[model samples]
Target: MRTACFIDGYNVFYGLVAGTSFKWLNLPSLIQHIVHVEAPESQLTSIDFFTSGVKPSLASRGSQSKEAQDTYLRALIAKGVVVHYGRHQLEARNAPRFISKQSPPSRLDQVAIWKLEEKETDVHIAISMYRLASRQASLPAEERVQQLVLVSADTDMTPALKAIKEDFPDLRLGVILPHREGTKRTTPGSLKNHSHWMRRLVTTEELAAHQLPERVPTKKRPAIKPEYW
Candidate 1:
């Protein structure tokens, strides 16, 4: 089976890599491993990774964070992954101040804050997936992507999955939630409903084994792993 994978980069980072030692992940290796395990007949043909550039001012590690992201993105490109860039928008907005979890938020008690949103990523992923499905519909059976795998836990993608399932019954759909081992997270029912199969958790051993080399070569220079990572 010919397969193509779509990745929601922010979702995977927050769900699996945040506060973890697996920052230097080799995305293609990991996804290919998962695909082979789930369906041995699958031959992963392409990967499209959607992400926004990191804002240095908003990052915990400031400039270092941005630099790390740039390096990592370069490495991914060098390894044949197609990257789609979105953008971060920081705006001032009003929202209810959180007092306690027991107390419901009231609009009367509002505070002004800077809201940073990663724009266009979700829309981009959705449109890209649907577009791929549409294109595949016209291709010869041997050239078409028989399976489409999504590497995300975000429920926002449910609608897109639904459309593909409805319009292209012959195309196989799969979801791989970016939840890590030892973490307890509810399975997204909507995504599961649309997918032919779903893989709920990624093990630490799998992550460790699929990490990129300490230095990844690019056309200009070698992308080195950040020391803090």
Candidate 2:
């Protein structure tokens, strides 16, 4: 049977950026690796990646530490990873953060940075799954996508996933957990509706097998001001 993979770029990336300090993985190649682990019996027909186009440095986080983020994201696209993007968001509000009053002591010499939060990533993922699901079910006149496997932890996607399972039981829809700290999705009634959540993609050591080519990265992640705060 033909299998398809979908990735929630923002959801998965946020987990890595928050939980761990390392952020170097060949995403396109990563999907290739995930294909085998998720559907060992099937070959991938598509791997649609969804995310917003905003770089963290200037948008919300303002962290130059995220310098290589755009670089790697574009690299995935060059390798033929399907990328879906949403616009960056801007809002005005009281942005409270932590700051040290150096007068206290050396331990109090730090500052906190905050910015507007954009929430279009989840929307993009939902739309893709819905579109693919509809295309797979209704048999689109334009294209035909076989099986679908959504990779993310956003419980918001539960409804769409359920649609595939109930409406198209034979469609082969599965959910993938975003964080892979040896953790698993355990919503009390999550699987009661559908038990198809898989683990995250390839580990760090196996990055070589999943990296996109060398040329693409240089183009997508251009020379933007550093994002480190």
Top lDDT: which candidate number?
A: 1
Give a tens-digit lDDT track for model 2, residues 53-146.
6565574454443445566565566556788776666555443343466534344344444445656777677677767766665665335555
The predictions' CA RMSDs to the true structure, in order, are 1.0, 7.1
Stretches of candidate 2 above 4 Å error?
17-22, 55-67, 94-115, 137-144, 182-192, 195-197, 200-229
Model 1 misplacement above 4 A? none
Q: List model 1 lDDT by residue over 140-228, tens digit each.
A: 88799999999988899999999999999998999999999999999999999999999999999998999999999999999999999
Q: How does each model score on TM-score?
A: 0.97, 0.67
Give the alpha-carbon lDDT of every model. 0.94, 0.59
In candidate 2, where is summed lDDT lowest over 10 consecutive residues?
220-229
Q: Candidate 1 lDDT (Cα, whole model)?
A: 0.94
User: Candidate 1's error at 138, in angstroms?
Assistant: 2.9
lDDT, model 1, position 175: 95
Mind sharing the TM-score for model 2?
A: 0.67
For each candidate, how many residue pairs have backbone atoms clashing (under 3 Å)?
A: 0, 7
